[model samples]
Target: MPTPSAPSAPVADGGLFCELYWGTSLAEAWSYGPELGQVHAAPDETAPLPLYGFTLPEEPFLLAERTPRGWRIHVPPSARVEKSLKGDAFHPVGPEELTGAPGRAAVELREGMTLRLVEGELRLLVQPSVVKERAGRFRVRDVAWLITVAILFLSAPVAFLTMGPDPARLAANNARALQVAHDKEEARRKAMGLDQPLKPLTEAERATQKQDGGARVNVPASFGVR
Candidate 1:
């Protein structure tokens, strides 16, 4: 006899980072908006944050995990990281005094990077900007293409639903079904010695049969008319 298979493992409810949030040694905080402590010179226009890849100021660093609300960075406790901070002069002063707050000033990790919290905001300092020249009207063309694709994506299902079966084909199928039913009725009638042609209903017969009034007339009442 063959050996039975083992039962599968139970599925987890949330992502790895989220499931481990409480137990993990690192203190975690969620970002409210799209910005993740981005350092921008332009104070008015808060541009979108930079890419994930960044330069670490020191060996001791935090990791940012993407979450539904926003990005979540995990920072190890001050007590756990105190010894490591001694090696770097640029590290936060008096490491033991450090406390993890949900929303405070952005924490500066290094020369080019900083992490801070303000109310519900979480912004990270990124490297200085690098200007890029536009590739001309090609961008406009790409936008147009994307719009066309989106329209097609939406309209495809509507078109499929709106399309109806051919009227001629439907009529032919109905006729075929009616013929089959008539043949079956004729066979039944022949067995009963009543295989005669079906006469058109007279006005009085139609009225008594309730065919004209949309009410089903009693069979005996219709037969009594003749």
Candidate 2:
């Protein structure tokens, strides 16, 4: 996932050239890899501007250009911290479904990972790094989703197969037998308790219990085993 080498050397009226590609989805094009933050920056005379509070990766993230200070990323106070944690299945910040942004925009996910957006769509700069890493190591991304779906898909048959055995079948039959046995035991318990006086129940507990036939069994005092 090599970036197309620095478009040019550092300039004063510092021009961070970028080629970004935003789409209805971040991954629709190229730039926005699956991470925290990617911010585009330009020189401002007055204020030390603030950025959104998306956190950065703990490890050294891929940066398009290296600074003389080495690959250093900054987190700003004004940066808006996300409502929830990252990798939450979808973006909490977005509902717009915007594809890309074009400018000297400094885009970042909740990580120190920074990309210098050269002139173009930010999508271009966002290489498929995470996808690449996952793909490179174990082809996890390629198969992960399928593996998950497969597990879910195979669940039905696997469950059937597990129960397809003699032991499981026997166990299941025994479970049914036991259930009947338990029901008979429960009935006997009710019969035993019926001879006793009623017990107190909390108001809420009694209210709920009343819905399901109170006290497990509500035989009248006069009723006998006969």
TM-scores of all predicted structures: 0.30, 0.16
Clash numbers, per candidate: 9, 51
For residue 201, what is the lDDT in candidate 2? 81
Candidate No. with top lDDT: 1
In model 1, pairs of residues that clash are 36-123, 36-124, 37-123, 37-124, 38-124, 104-117, 106-115, 106-116, 107-115
lDDT of 1 by residue, 134-223 (tens): 235658889999999999999998888679577888999999999999999989989998977779999898778875557565566446
User: Worst lDDT window (10 residues) for model 2?
Assistant: 45-54
lDDT of 2 by residue, 156-177 (tens): 9878977776986789999999
- Tell me model 2's lDDT, rounded to 2 decimals: 0.38
Q: Where is model 1 poorest over a 10-residue stretch in terms of lDDT?
A: 11-20
Candidate 1's displacement at residue 153, Å, is 2.5
